[model samples]
Target: MFRVLVLILAFVANPSRAAAAPPDVDLELVLAVDTSGSIDIGEARVQRLGYLETLRHPDFINAVKSGYLGRIAIGYFEWGGKVNESSVVAWQVIEDAKDAEAFAAKLEARPIATRHGTSISSAIRFGTRLIETNAYFGARRILDLSGDGFNNTGLPIAVARNDALARGIVINGLVILIRPTVSTVPLERYYAECVIGGPGSFMIPVRNVEDFASAVRQKLLLEVGGLTPSLTAQPAAMHAPVDCRVGEKYPSFVEPAFRN
Candidate 1:
């Protein structure tokens, strides 16, 4: 009777300590997409549709099931100069096809809007915060960032990238090159040198709009399965290292209103 009273007292003193902890997930993935002025509505739509389809793909579903926990938590958000609350899709756990479809539907329903500036650093910082504060504990945390341009605003890309790496968060890149940018450095090289870091980190460049869907699906597969691509499939190494600050040197590229 005395031990029981002591236990009850402890529970009353620390209710949270007696409560169940957050669920464990195989991976915590934050999908940080660029909605800078450079991406027109059509291009944005393509990105949105590509992700929606990829989530429902059989290969991606299989990858999720192959995880040790058979589940992963994902959060989606669009970032430009800064992250807006309206652009964020709260974290969702995906363990099966139904969950994937529901999360994709939530993303598809959100209205797309492009904002000024290209701030990859802002996106990275925001993603890190989301991971740090999320309710699930994951075996691996990844920030999958997609962008058409470089980091022209906010903190330095290396700073944010390194900070995330220090927190054991892997950063991957999707370099969308369907449209041209003013920067002389190849976008892929820039991403390799500055934006992506941590173990198994890589960047995939989409040179054609037609390849966007496949590239996204392939990236999701590799990340979900925790596998790295072969050396031949990796981004080609450049003769000289890229200037990480090159984006800050050039003006932000804005798509013309008439262009699709």
Candidate 2:
């Protein structure tokens, strides 16, 4: 199995020995970030800061703590293509404020260059593999997808999305409309209509790059715990998780789970 170890505060708090496993969080969140060539270095910086700022935000911290077990597992990765990509942060379980900040600090310290392609399918595939490896499938599995554009390479989004849903995985979208000459609601429509899926899945578009922080805050609030969408803020219904083992898309995207 592909594995890399890092000191995680949650692991310390709930140590799992060789013969035993720790109690899992009620949710496993996979944050898939876009590092495609389309996103310039400056914009990537803005997107990167959005995550750091969210982790720094007290509201996000509270949201993490608000889970049924007062904790949630999270992993962050950057995907733009099948190769020449890297990990932003590994699978993490934030059981407390300290753990959350540790993740933020790690991201802040990493320096990134722009050379990845827009491969949303591969990103989703990576996310599913990550969650399965965490052994937190029984927990609520969420693949948090953030990107500025549509899927161009690898598998078709609907195919991957439908497969993810069939595996009881919820995929939420954070669609960023960079320097949109017109309005961003249209871009978000693409998300709601195409990219976003799974139970309670919804997309939050950052119309203005300046609004990135706010969008992240709102999305995190809803994504972590089951929070209702705000009608005042482009309200949309959330998608329900699906498992099509015996239905359409059966055995789709479920191979990674088994392989893991």
Candidate 3:
């Protein structure tokens, strides 16, 4: 069944999976982490190591294999003032267990070496270019931007979102909410409304950096398998009400197998 789906998706994608551009990279997903001034070195390590740990877990491997095609392209970058931001991993195509292991190992070995302004736009643009420059076009292309602030530099988010969407890029977000008195609800909404683009885009907010693991898992599941992204971590109070308004926004990608 998975093979058939891969063939179909690959077939619809022009001559061959390798032939397509832009939305290239079978199951491409970018990890856009925050290294802005707000994040101290300890917090940055937590964020970086958190994802490296998640990728090393067996569950992430299973998630990578969840797609009919086991191939996935990934790129990592730090977002901040355009000057402070740069790519951690250029463009990596993980096609199997060894590839995933190597990529995870590399990430684990990489040190936290960025501290600058938090510009979500720079990260988004970097991810978009990574996808556009790749030879592998996956069934899914996602720019997973995790940050604690809204856009403050470079291009405005709306224009960047349009550019990404025009190229069939899905900009899912991982918004880290830490302030007790300050709710990150507005930030998450900003992501959902302005930051992310494409048919099936969503955002998840992590109230605390400690919960980053679970949030990373949830985001990974949704990104690779096309699961419905919702705030399952209910606060004593709900910020975005989960109502019967199902499939109201992201109605494009959803399936039974994807829920895995």
- Give the number of the best model, judged by lDDT: 1
lDDT of 1 at 38: 88
Over the full model, what C-alpha lDDT does candidate 1 score relative to the true structure?
A: 0.82
Better of 1 and 2 by lDDT: 1
- Residue range 170-247, candidate 1, lDDT tens digits: 999999998868768878778888999987899888888788799899999999998877777657644877878886
TM-score of 1: 0.84
Residue lDDT tens for model 3, 1-260: 76556556544433344354333344878787877777777778888777877777777777777666566788777766652333477567765667777887877766676555655666777777777676666776678888777666655555566777766677888887775224334666666666766656788878887988888877887787767565466558545642212212322433221010
User: Number of clashing pairs, model 2?
Assistant: 8
Query: Compared with the true structure, what per-residue lDDT tens digits does model 2 show for residues 1-260?
Result: 11112123223322342125434575678888877787788888888888888888888878877765677878887877552335557767787778999988887877866665566777777777776567553246688888876666666666667667666677898887775424333556656766777656778877777887788878887877666476576567675532221112222443343333
Candidate 1: where are CA atoms >4 Å away? 1-23, 233-239, 249-260
Better of 1 and 2 by TM-score: 1
lDDT of every predicted structure (CA atoms): 0.82, 0.68, 0.67
| TM-scores for every candidate against the unseen true structure | 0.84, 0.76, 0.77
Worst window of 10 by summed lDDT in candidate 3 = 251-260
Clash count, candidate 1: 0
